[model samples]
Target: MHTLLKNLKVEINDKLYVKDPESSDLGKRILSCSIEMIYELGFEQFTFKKLGLAIKSNESSIYRYFENKHKLLLYLTSWYWSWLEYQLVLQTLTLSVPKDKLNRAVEILTQEVTQDSNFSHIDEVLLNKIIISEYSKSYLTKEVDIENKEGYFAVYKRLVLRLKDMIKEVDPAYAFPASLSSMVIQGALHQHFLKDHFTAITDCNSTTTPTSYFLNLIDQLIISNGKK
Candidate 1:
């Protein structure tokens, strides 16, 4: 697990929030409770009004930080990707070998998320659950193009690029590094999604935990320096 410095706030895009939610007690409450409420109630059923009541703040007060629930979801998912990218960087950097870095990257990306002690206001473990169930809603929308143009996906892209670099370091001549890296990342998550929501669809999960299964696939698919 990545150690979060005390009160280490991950600043998301200003476009995701009207005002920085981490700046005030109420703002922090909104962020903290929103993750909890959304995880409990699902995003479709979660509302600022419910959040306002839960936190004992007025509904209008919640509007000061986010324009709408979709934006809040955007903010949450954005923060998640940023946090994940940070973990990938820290985990991979301490390892010297190129193949080891690639392996560590996939391992961190695929494993079940655990709560970190450093980011006190955010429950990352619950947030990871939200990502598994609700994140696609943030991007699979009519405004996705506009949001993409405004760089809403920057953190996720940065992660893919980091993985792409590690893949290239292992296999300079390999074609489709970006696609391969993204497949591993997204495929791991989707497999988890299937396991939790659609039990009968995925069978390979029967053999091993998804992380171990995917790591083995990585080793099989790409023989770095033809070592495999």
Candidate 2:
């Protein structure tokens, strides 16, 4: 799978960036440094000037790739989801059993991310950390509806729809497949955040991860619904 993915490009929306970061050495450097800087400084504190220094390039050069920090965040989040969608498809595509496929989908969506050597320029693990912590900032804005119309969140919505389809396959009568799908994706991020900072409020820890919680949730919700 890694070999297959090495040649695969996780395409993001063209509107997300001024230039394709994967096209040039400097462009790739911009993405690599931006991910590191955003993970280290937090998005609110991350700046073009800071990323420029990290990559030893001018701030304007960074702008050639991304218009501003918010656009950059949008690009990053979009890339993460596109990559994750690849994983979900590759991992679950072969299962003949509906429930088994759904279970694997839940596990992939909820489990903590690990580094992928196929894409060396971006650290998916750090990107996942950013998603868990700062993903809301990408869309929690007045422009969200406008951006949604522009298809800025297309990859994410597509991912949710994939899970929704999987849920429907398990229980065609399930009325809330869309809700459950989005909840598992969004709830996994929330639970990871809670486990990291608000430990007192969540039961998820190193062993009892969000993956386990959501897996059990699917069993109860979809499986039980099927039995009924």
Candidate 3:
């Protein structure tokens, strides 16, 4: 078994090493490499040995950053959430009105699904698999649920809350819950991603872009609900 260190200065057999930004970069590299490998090969087939080969880094270097594969997965999840928050902030800042800001947020999310090369082609399938699996596990394990309750869900939650507030301003009698509004927004944004199997069952045009559908849906929802 590997021995644990107590402080920033890790001592192994009278040797001391200081962790720095380079170490952090190394950790990120390892996480990125692991994500790529997991995308190429399913998680069950992904291994540290394979990841090291893909990144051209030694396993010992990776171990210095992460204790095991599970820890690496957690790190990847955190990285995704952090990057998503940054994206949302950048998108939200471009608009002045709350309604426009929420609209832009939906547009950004939809555009991300189609335009982001990270989620394009085969990588998209891999990512969807990983997201579905992680979400299910998080739901069951209570770790992610706990994190959400503790305010780690602030970015996404705040985006929804802002949208709900806008809806309220437009119409006080809007009866739908914020959660339902958020889901509808997300569903509208993800329609393209879900179109493959859905096409056979529905007559809706698949040619429409996610951003267009999202904005149209938001406008219609607001107009219809405001009259009630």
Report the error of model 1 at residue 43, Å.
0.9
Over 146-182, each residue of candidate 3 has an lDDT whose tens digit, in order, gives 6556554454455567557656655666677496557
Model 1: colliding residue pairs: none
TM-score of each: 0.93, 0.98, 0.61
lDDT of each: 0.86, 0.93, 0.53
TM accuracy, model 1: 0.93
What is the per-residue lDDT of model 1 for residues 1-228, given as tens digits with 9 covering 90 to 100? 333455356768888889999889889899999999999999999998999999998999999999999999999999999988878877776799888888899888888899977788899999999998998899999999999999888888788889888888888778889998888877877888988878788754655667887788778767534442
lDDT of 3 at 69: 62
Candidate 3 pairs with clashing backbones: none
Put the candidates in TM-score order, highest first.
2, 1, 3
Candidate no. 3 TM-score: 0.61
| Candidate 2 accuracy as lDDT | 0.93
List ranges where model 1 is wrong by over 4 Å: 1-4, 204-207, 224-228
* Deviation of model 1 at 151, angstroms: 1.0
| Poorest lDDT segment (10 consecutive residues) of candidate 1 | 1-10
Better of 1 and 3 by TM-score: 1
Q: Which ten-residue region of model 2 has the weakest summed lDDT?
A: 219-228
Best by lDDT: 2
